[model samples]
Target: MQLHSSGVQYKLHLCLSVTLELILKILELKLMVVIMIKDWNVMDLVCTCVTTLLLVLICLLLYFISVYPENCGSYHGPHSINCLITIWEEVGCKIKGLRYPGVLTNADANTLKIMNLRNVKANMESVKSAADGGNADQQLNCYGIAIPNTCDSHNGPHSVECLTSIWESKGCLSEGTKAPVKLNTAEKEALALLNLE
Candidate 1:
C-alpha cells in the first residue's frame, strides 16, 4: 500500500468524520420533521425548532469552512472559491443527468486522476532520460546569430558577461578613447536574442 504523510491522513480522517456527522444530523432532522408533522404539541415544536436552528447553524459553518479553507488565504480567496463552486456545479449537473443517481459517482474523477498520473509518469521518465545524457554544452544561438566570446567561461560564448568582454576589446569602455560607443552587430544580435534589447 502507498504511504501517506501524517498531514494527509489527518485531513482525510477529519473529512470522513465531518461527512459522517453531517449525514447523522440530516437523518436526525428528517426524523424530527416526521415527529413534528404527526404531533403538534408545544414542547415538541419548540425542541424541533431549536434542533433545526442548531443544525442550520452547523451546516452554514461547514459550508463556510469548505468554501474558504485555510489554504484559501494563500490563493486569491474569492476567485478560488468561485472556481471550486463552478467545478462542484458541473459535478452536480452530471449527477442530475445520471439514469438512477442515488449515490455520488467518482467515474470522471478516477479517469482524470489516472490520466494525470500517466502524464506525471511520462514527465518523470523524460527528466530521467535527460539527466542520463550528462551535462552537454549549451551553445546559445540568438535569432540565427552567434555571439562570439572574448573570455572563456562555463556559460560558453553566448553569455552576456562574455559579450561585455568582447565589447571592451572593441574599445567600448569607460576612460577609453571610445567610451560610450554604439554596439556592434554581434553584440546587438546577442542582446536581442537574450531578450535584453
Candidate 2:
C-alpha cells in the first residue's frame, strides 16, 4: 500500500507540471498578440499624420496660385507692381518716335525714358480698391482701364498700345511732352462714331 500511494503522488506531480507549461505558453501568445496590435496602431497613426500634412500643403499651393498676379490677370501685389513697371520700361525703350505726351524728353540718352507714371497711380488705386473689398469692376475702374473679356486681350505689344491710347484719351498726359492735335479726318470720324470726343 505504501508503494502504490507513492506512484499515485508521482503521477499527480507530472499532470500538474504539464498543465503549468500549457498555461505559460497561452500567456506568452496573448502578450505577443497585444504587442503586434500596439505596433499596428503606431503605424496607422504615422500614416494618417503624413497624409494630413500632404493635403494641407496641396491646399496652400492652390491658394498661392490663385492669388498670384499672373494668374489673377492683374497687379494684385507688390511683386505684380514691380513686374508691370519692368514691362513698361521695356516697352518704352522699344517704341521709337512715339513720344509719351507730358513726359520730359531726354534726347541725350539712346533709349527714350517713357516712364508710365500712370501705371504707378493705377497700382495704388487697385490696392485701395482691394482694401475696400470692391469687386473686379471697381478694381478695374480704380486702375482706369477696362478688364479684357478674353485672355487674348492681354497678348502682345499691340495690347499695350491700345491700353496707352485709352489712358491718353482720358487726359492722363505726361508732364513735359506737348499734346499734338494731329488727328486725321478718318480718326476724327472714328472718334465721332465711338462718341469718344
Candidate 3:
C-alpha cells in the first residue's frame, strides 16, 4: 500500500517536472524572439507576452486537474479504480479484440479479475504457509516486520496472534481470519477488473 502511494506521487512529480521544463523552454524561446526583434511595438510585445503566459498557465492548470481528479460519482468504479486503468495503459497492458467491444464490459472485467486472482491467491497462500512455518522470527521478516527479541513475547511458534498480525498487516486473508484484506486503491481496482476482488 505504501509503495503504491509512493508510486502515484512519483508519477505526479515526474509529470509536473516535465511540464515545468517545457514551460521554461517555451519562455526561453519567447525571450530570445523578443530580444532579436527590437523594432516590436510596446503594445504588441505586451500582448504577446500576456498571451504566452496565459497559455502556459492554462496548460499547467489542466495538467494539474488531470493528475488530481475530483471525486466523480463512481458509476463505473471509484477514482482509484480509474487510476489503475491509466497505469496499466501506460505500461502497455492491453486487452485487444474485445469480446463485446465498448471498453471493459462485464465479461472482460470478470476474466481479467479471475486471472489476477489466481496469481495473487497463489502467491498469498505461499506466504501464509511460510508464515505458519516453524520459525517465528523468520515470519517476522517475511511481513517486513522487525524481529522482536521473542516471538509473541515468548508465546512461541504456532502463536495464532502473531500469525494473524503478520498476514493481516500485509493484507492477506488467511484461511481462518474473518476480516477482509485491506488493499490499496490500485490493487483493489486491479483485482476487481480481473474479477479477483
| Cα lDDT of model 3 by residue, 1-197, tens digit | 11223355665676667666766776676567678875456546666766776686666555443332232222233234344343333322232312111255665545433433234234334433444454444344233333232233322332334444545666777653342244545543443332100
Clashes of each: 0, 7, 5
TM-score of decoy 3:
0.24
Per-residue lDDT of 1-197 in model 1, one digit per residue for the tens?
A: 12323455565566657766765766677577677775546446656666776676566545434332222221222223223223333322212222111222455333323333334224334432332233221111111112244333222324445556555766677455323235566655555354211
lDDT of 3 at 186: 53
Error of 1 at 183 (Å): 83
Candidate 3 lDDT score relative to the true structure: 0.42
TM-score of the candidate numbered 2?
0.20
Rank candidates by TM-score, best first: 3, 1, 2
The local distance difference test score of each candidate is 0.40, 0.38, 0.42
How many Å off is the CA of 15 in candidate 1?
1.3
Residues 6-87 of candidate 2 have per-residue lDDT tens digits of: 3445555555565556556555654575587756665555556556555655554443333222211333333233344344
- Looking at model 1, the pairs that clash are none
